[model samples]
Target chain A: MTSGIRPKRDEETVIAGSCDSENPRRVDGLQLLGEYRGAAYEEPRFLVYRPDGQAVLLTPLLYRVLTHLDGRHSLASVAERVSADHDRAIGPDGVRYLVEQKLEPLGLAVLGAPVEQVPTADPLLSLSARGVLFPARMVRTIARLFAPLHLPAVVAATLGTLLALDLWMFTSGQADAAIRTTVGDPAAMLVGVGLLLVSTLFHECGHAAGCHYGGARPGAIGVGLYVVFPVFYTNVTDAYRLNRAGRLRTDLGGIYFNAVFIVVLGCAYLTSGYAPLLAAAVLVHGQIIQQLMPTLRMDGYYIVADLVGVPNLFGLIGPIVAGLARRGRRGGRHAWRAEINLRPFARRVVIAWVLLVIPFLAGGLAVMLLRAPTYIGIAWRSTAERWTAVEQAFTHGQVATILIDTFATLMLWLPWVGLGFLLARVLQRAVRAGIRAVNRRR
Target chain B: MVEDMTVLEREHVEFLPSREALGGLVNVNIVVPVNLAIAVLGSAALACQNAVGIIR
Candidate 1:
């Protein structure tokens, strides 16, 4: 009954022979966060981490091994216990190999090794640019305050209220009336924009609250500039420690809060006869749909990812493709199995996602690139029109029109601007990768 | 717990590296640009209203 340990296999981390380290210390901030018995996960997994750093999973036996790496325990000591527990003959050399090759490389253990970040080949469509809005400490405090809102009874009540509101808004002709009132009145339009922003911020809080409710600590809240648009985010990266239900809750929490906001907006509209509030309620439904766009790093993207039990779907593309190539070259056997370490169910889901995603994003980006001139000209013309509208509003002294048109003009051209930034970033990564590949070739 | 007496028992507990289930640096984010969505949707609605003489 010997325990075997290996890092999640990737191109960078190769299985190597026995190592030479005699003593390895756990990194200063490293921690073993305990076992994950989340029912949603296909297997029992262990969690280890450093606050605000990477979260690594380990096997049960490997979790045991990590527990012994206090720098005081000799390689022979760990090997002896593991050998006894595993009922196998693992020598000190074997222990050293596990520590040096597996743990140290992942920033878990160190033996005077220079700390280096593991290189991740992020997917082409990943949202890599981000900045924090609220620090971890503050978000944690705020999230805890909102935790009660997710209590089972409260969640049920909120959902019921949301459902009832939707029914009334559509059936009672409130939604149509609200939209007309909002669009025709310039001030209502500007207020609708403001409400959407506020609702988005509220949505981030939902994620934080969900994480807190799930017995996991949430980090900061922030915004990330995903390829072309600003996306509000709450760093619920800590949610990995939770079970499948908990993780899913974190993923769906944003939209759930949107529901809550809608309910509040509906109530306010009914109470005060506020047209703009009702307008916000209506426009927010669009935000909900947009959030659910299955592509990109949106809430929908994460929902799919959590459902499949895969974190980075894009990262698996290279390995899965390589596995396919190997299958083709090696008589089409179970060679792909060696490439992906997922359970069969998750593996299939991930593969299907890769199939659909690659062409969709590639084709979409291709069209965007190919027709760049036409799109840019259109954007420029639209912006100019809105600008002219703003000038006309000023001449007529229509403050509401000026405000609403001004907001629309700014938003109208941002997506095209985002495309430009996306191109620059992708180029930077490709150039960096190219340089590295060239150096490796030498 | 080293009393695992057989390979079958050991098979279940072999320690291996785990893959994180979240994406990117911050895991998940709501990528919908509220400002943009409301802008486009509002513009189209207003344009329709103008055509039908509501905004005038």
Candidate 2:
């Protein structure tokens, strides 16, 4: 249904000049969802929703043209309508081009019969999450239960708890002793690891709750192998529809949950003097810090991206680096412009982040590479010894020893499994590249 | 379709130069750097403790 707003007849005549007789083209199942002014761009952007669960941003002019595509008007007439409404000269050719190139890609319109699919390869192989474990309904329920924790009173409590915990750690040597004992005691270390995993799950829940609080629907929670590490991930992509604060809350929600967990642990330690809980709190702190490392797409990187109002900032690294190289080669006098979809300030921030990240990542990778052999050797020896122990226990019919040894053996081999996955991924990419090259030649 | 239109009408539209954007800049410039510093100092302290056999 049209909004019932129409332009003046004289304005329509000027816009429809000599091209309003073509076949009317209509947008199939396209819906104008909403509009938002982006921090990165000057123009107000409209979200056009397709029936296929996908949404794309369009400029106001394009949106105006789209609104007129009710199958009752031809492309020329649509152009005329938009031009009349906006008091500008938008020709039929411009309308045709926009419909064919822009709208067609988004599956927003039927330009004719469907085009043949081209087999194109993506240069990057993204590790996608396996499946949704916690569905949207379950997530929403959980999010509601924890929504009150985001209140001002809870915020004050969190701050108080942090200060108290810091004071405790500063005054007493118990934290250090607890950490040392936890590290040396295998049983304690295992329990601590379990606690950390639970905390990580809660961290993801925190993200979901924040999205819910921000009026965005939280999707599924799933696990994926990010690089070599199997990590938990939550689908908060609907947070994209939200403004900057909403998205930032979702990004920082995990760490906020970590803080809440620490507060509970700190209170427990104060009351019971159980140092291992404090030690677990320390480990959670380490995890939080690790997540803050912006080299990888973790909380810290998302925070940066959200702050600059850019999505998929990592994907822009290639073009930004290339733009820098091009600038250097041109003697750095003229301004180098790369076709990056970012505001000027955002572009600068991204360039700075890339420069900082590249060195940090390279240094970290170099260290890991240098220590790989020693690490692998240690793991192999440990796993072999554990396996032998397990075998001996099995023969002796020592059930407890067998179980313990089996667990130990599996723990030792986990790194090897991760390495194998990494190698397989690399080999798969190489094979795909070779096949593509051969096909290109053919 | 009527329900969808109602939802769209209720959507909150904020213009650019949003408070969220400014807050994000502060977070990246100030908060992240402070966190990074804390991590570096903590690592150094841990390394020192390890060297002195305090952690062993």
Candidate 3:
């Protein structure tokens, strides 16, 4: 046999050969996070944490081979060790096959190299804002301080407060008045908007706190544009190392924090009889409801994903749809099956989620597109009026008016900017499709 | 004689990966139909409101 690794035709088996002694296959810095027993799946799985905050699940057999890759052992030696330990004849070829097919794809195994450079522009990185704010260490410190609030008693108290606020709103008849007053007064609207912004920041902190509580390291907390709307996101990807319950807690933590903020606002409304505070509380409730929408990559989507033990439910949608189309064309009676990394039950749940989400998303997008021009025009006019007011306030040396006008301008221009972004995205997709068609013809 | 032979056969059996059957009944069968019902009812209600001029 030649003393070099060669790719085999069969996916399950590789051609057994002597590996190079000088350049041994090694697992660089892959952290093995023990085993995870998912409720949906029969087999126990383990997680491999990558340097770039991505986690990959592996079967026990693959994990055993991973433990043997310590930079010193050749592929042959590693296979021998696994065979000795497990009493199964997993030859060097099998080891190489697993490493190349599984581990290498996840960036866990390094073959014939000590270090691999991180990609400068990962597709996921584009979804997030540039640069990190609140590094891991800082997040950990803040999380430690808020750890006490995550206790059972504190959680119960927060839930009680929410119930009380709901009861009060039902009885007092002030809810409608608060909404009307806030809508009528620009100043009140601005105050409510400001409160909403602050509450969103608090919501992100809650996610970080939940991650810490679950014994996972929360990375940066930053602001970025999700589609057109600016949103706060905490890097709680490490929560995948946690069990399903812990992951769910992390997903729901943001909404929990929003509830806490609402309670505080409710108390303020009760004390000062401030209509704007109550209005802001109502707005926060609306925000929580919106976040619970599972159609998008929001908290509810993550919650469902964790519940079903599927990491990338959205990614599976395209394949599932394509498979369905193919099956229909072939006149198959049964639903088309694809190799999505999900259990039977979880797969069913994902299909249901996709079916519900598709129509809702399509309808929402259709409505938005139909009304875009009118909405855009209104936003433009409002922003111009606000800007003119701002200039007048500035010329008159009225600092307070200028601040209010600036806030108003921001509020007005945001919708316009969002519509523009949506238009641009649609056009880009259309252009790409046209280019593909042209290439096909050529 | 038969028991002794069965035991020997069991000892030499090879372990194979489990191939669980993908059952016919899925959660989507129930959920998708129910969601469709809701959508139909909701659109009907909206149409009624619009006809009555209660909604613009």
Candidate 4:
């Protein structure tokens, strides 16, 4: 049945003595079904009829909003009522807008004033929330640049050369002066920091471009924190929706981009002998170390996930932990149980997770425990440092100076243990899943 | 005939096996096409690393 639009009428569609001015209304009428303690009406009582014959089964409070909207009470009064009732500082315009947006489409709500975008509902993952957060805008920008690169062997060879050369320099002790010099110069430091930021942006673009190549739309990119470490994330969630081949492209996108960028950076280093290139090289080297760290939620971890055909290794950890918990509860019940109930592949995988997690978790805990005081002290000092920087900037009118310095500091420390843990958990699951596949085959 | 066709269609769409489904009924967990791409990448990364002399 097609519901056509109905004309608006300017009258208070009042419920007969059902509404109380003292009390509030809920939007959902079914919730208020029991609240009408003394109200009486025919079947389907307390319905405030809209102009289009679409009746809103209002709770007493909602009906008040409708009753007050007589084109006489200003929208402000309505907003205040809603705010008082809902505990949200919903503006008069917001309430009307929300009601209007819902009603106009259904031909139930009539316009009293213009509608605007409502206040954002508080999100679970705040901009501050730690872990794998990607902003959509940055991801889109990245995708545009990422789409042109081909999977040329030369690109890989070039990247390989850069990494080897950097490692060679560090091992040979020839790069120490270069590193020290780059760190000492503020102008050099800024360039190094800028290049690192650009590389990260390129990394996310890799993921987006990979998704595009794989027939998926790359979504939003944003800043997210992995525990205390802040990261830039692009929403390539659509990549997961694609086939395993497509998913791999998305996973490798960042590294592929990194490889190409390093070649360019390396060439610049070779040509100019600039101290900034050395700094950039060091920063790029650090990024490579991070992405290759298979134990964390880095690019390497996602590559493993895609290889293992796991949609979300991180999400699977909770269920795996729960299963372990249940096993612990069973305790000795299975002491003499059939040892070979699971397929060989599944058993091998279970063993792998246990083997991987036990030492990793223990080692991680030990490291945390050992460094806890120092880390805490550093964090406190860092916080103090940030505030100091901000205050000094403000007092001296050098906000840009402080901000640039702060961003540089974040790049240095962002890919530490926090990201390691995230990636570790992901890798553990991927490895276990792979083992499970092998066992199933047997 | 129509009922038989509907039953086949339902089975085709129902990809995953139930926890209660027998092991023999389980199809081989074939590595999807994308997984192959990732393997290629992993090898590529390793190959790139080798070429660059990260590993001798």
Candidate 5:
């Protein structure tokens, strides 16, 4: 190997495929790291340096192989195992080639016959690793059910009207008294509760339909937590491939649909003065308020993401915050300058003073923690009460209201947690894939 | 575990030379799930406020 080579003065001597010989030895199994051309490896990549000082960028596949190559496998045995796992045969030539190309460079294998170095691949994206809440089957099914629909403009119009009515209800506060009434008729209260749930479904449908109209394929929809916050999400990663206008359509689509539903619900409420209609109107209007909150991750965040062309705006926020923190730790004036570069805003402010990072992270953690017990309690209470109500079938069917409300709550909260994980995973995968594809071409 | 990779001949380094069509890298993030979960939870929480007579 090019030995006796003098190092250049200025450049950081990049000794390609040479091991550090003078360093102290590590444990028997743990060896060196390898380095490759930085351009070849992407971000979210890890580098391992052998105790000898040579660095290697572990590919996802190579990383996995290495993990399984305990002392239990001989050189040929390891080769056979890898070949079997990868659905290929690793003959002597293949094994030797791998040793020379990958394993040798990382200082894990020898060049000639009986090479021993084993390369590993990066970790697989596991659901359990990321704390997936529901079973994969359940997640898939719900997501399919919530999949974006290609509806007629008439349906879109109906949603838009509903959203408008919601705005009216909130702005007018006409539904407030009816919703707040305590001594209401039990039947009326039950109907109101049902209408409220129907409105939420309309809101979700709006998101799916908007995605369709925007010419993006909508994947599964489900619920999960964002940090600690319980949420329901729709998969619109397909929209990322669309142009700016298409993305905007998809982003604002949910609210538009919500508005249309509101108008219809509001008109009905006004005409009949029914308490249930008023409750439904209130429910629809609440979406507008929740969605518009910029501090929260909602439709508005997506709007901002689309507006800024940063489809993963929320994801970027964490990195930006981390970068700032690192700078601050290193006494960087830029980091301390408190110049926050959010997707839609660029400003200088006291991020720490604003407690943006702390509260945000804490809130997220809180949501995640609350998800389990709350869901459990809701399930337990709802089922027990519903069953009890059913048992007294002839006496009073009043228990139906309790059961209905309980199921509605579960349907709502369960999805928030389940879909959060799903959307994050699916869209993140699509974005990563898109990036890799672009990089490969370039 | 170290090997002198740079010393290998062209034939020995076949693993690095073979070209295969790469599929696009999908960065499967959990953002959608988180956002949707939050919205659902938030809306549900709000819905519960009415159901339990918390707001009333």
Candidate 6:
């Protein structure tokens, strides 16, 4: 979800690094998944990871060139083959220019004309400072094992169970009571929060399982630091291969799993009469709500994206905005076409999304910033109070309260910290952009 | 999406992770609501604890 535009620096990193000249060798051991040749794709998208976890989306013609990357093929040879295959005359210069300017900058392919070391994941497409909880092989196995759950009959039944549980809890006052019980009893709170966290992790598994069922291979399961908090994730990049239906399944997979988690929580609550289990179930409902918000870079956004058959709506925000700004001037009516590559219907949907999201996000961020002091005060006060509770619980040898308070304290404080990091990063980008603009102006 | 049949566009839109190909994206569920939930829940905890009186 990064802007593919790199600064004109001679820096040597793949944040947007590209090489001047070299064969269009797929980065050594590139895990780039191509579509099955038998007849699935007249034009399927290619996912090429940059050094950073972000990747660039390729148009089909570009993807064709990418598919030709065996490292042994010369630029001219590839150009020749792709031209003949697609009935398009993309010369060697066109191939080289595409690789050098577009693909190389992103480190999707190497033109190490004097190409230094090729940047493979060296082993994996990865996150920065990642800790793999389950390796790719294990992830594949898990996905395969759990694939049956995505069967339509099973999904419908699971959703039904969640609906029933939700109705029963809210209608019977079980939800309200569960929250009260969970909060009052330290053990209950501990168990409730613990189950919620586990359920979140299981949500990742749902994505893997869905991807597997949709005929796409999933990658490793791991925890990575996102904006300074630990987040569990499953790599379902290959899910892009599936048609819109398949992609939608992958998008909704996490929520489906959350429902499954809720079923288990409901069953536990029912059998053990555990209020906290039900309480945790309630929290899962909240989490599911958050996940469904198309505003954030979460599942809902992807759902919208997959529904429209556009892989990355976030990427379009820039182009569309620029197109709008340019159109305000004379002779810039068609500016949007240069940036947007989607069909009429898809393009319209993306524009609407961009319009909605820009204001919504901007307003939210502005409010948070303007009211930062107030939020910080609340967060600080809450964190201190939670920490105190932790200390008090420790003094009293109340293990469960100690656990609950400590976790609560962490939750209370991390966002402010994350926000701080967010601000700092934004400021850094602003200043860097300023410098780059100045350099360009000169 | 076929190759923009009319034009041999120079660039390919590389698909980044539709989902995190690399792992551990903590659902923003924790990210957004934890701010409010902890306070709300902690109060509930306190309300519940009023009876037990925190003596232990």
lDDT of 6 at A79: 85
Candidate 5 residues lying further than 4 Å off, grouped into runs, are A1-174, A180-183, A222-232, A294-297, A328-358, A363-395, A408-442, B1-56
lDDT of 5 by residue, A186-282 (tens): 4565566556555554555556556666654555444444432334455554454456676666666666656666677678878988767777566
Q: What fnat does each of the candidate structures reach?
A: 0.03, 0.00, 0.00, 0.00, 0.00, 0.34
Of candidates 5 and 2, the better by lDDT: 2
Can you write out model 4's per-residue Cα lDDT over B3-51, one digit (the tens) per residue?
2322222210000100000000001111121122223222332343234
TM-score of each: 0.81, 0.72, 0.73, 0.48, 0.45, 0.80
Backbone clash pairs for candidate 3 read none
Candidate 5 docks with a DockQ of: 0.05
Q: What CAPRI grade goes to candidate 1?
A: incorrect
Q: What RMSD does model 5 have?
A: 16.6
Tens digits of per-residue lDDT for model 1, A7-113: 23354332222224556667666667788544223445677764325565665556666777777778788777776765445667666666655666555676655
DockQ of candidate 3, scored on C-alphas against the true complex (2 decimals): 0.03
Q: List per-model TM-scores for chain B.
A: 0.38, 0.37, 0.38, 0.33, 0.35, 0.37
Candidate 2, pairs of clashing residues: A24-A74
TM-score, model 1 to reference: 0.81
Residue-wise lDDT of candidate 6 within A1-442, one digit each (tens)? Answer: 2453433333444233343445566654345545422122224455555444444556666778878977778988998888888756787877877777666655667776433432322111123344688898998898888889999999889989888888898899988988876777677676776787788878888888989998988888887544434567788877766767887788788888889989988998899897888888888887788778786567888888877777667767878888877876766755456456566777788889999888876776676667667767776787677677767777888887767666666656655565566667667667877998999999
Candidate with top DockQ is 6
Deviation from native of the Cα of residue A173 in model 5, angstroms: 7.0
At residue A407, candidate 6 shows an lDDT of 63
TM-score of chain A, cand. 6 = 0.82
| A264: Cα error in model 3, Å | 1.7
Candidate 6: misplaced stretches above 4 Å?
Answer: A1-27, A30-55, A66-80, A90-96, A103-112, A117-132, A224-230, A328-331, B1-18, B21-38
Weakest ten-residue segment in model 2 chain A by summed lDDT: A1-10
Instruction: Say which prediction, candidate 1 or candidate 6, comes out ahead on lDDT.
Output: 6
Which runs of model 3 end up more than 4 angstroms from their true locations?
A: A1-25, A36-39, A42-45, A84-89, A113-133, A183-185, A328-338, A362-374, A395-401, A411-442, B1-56
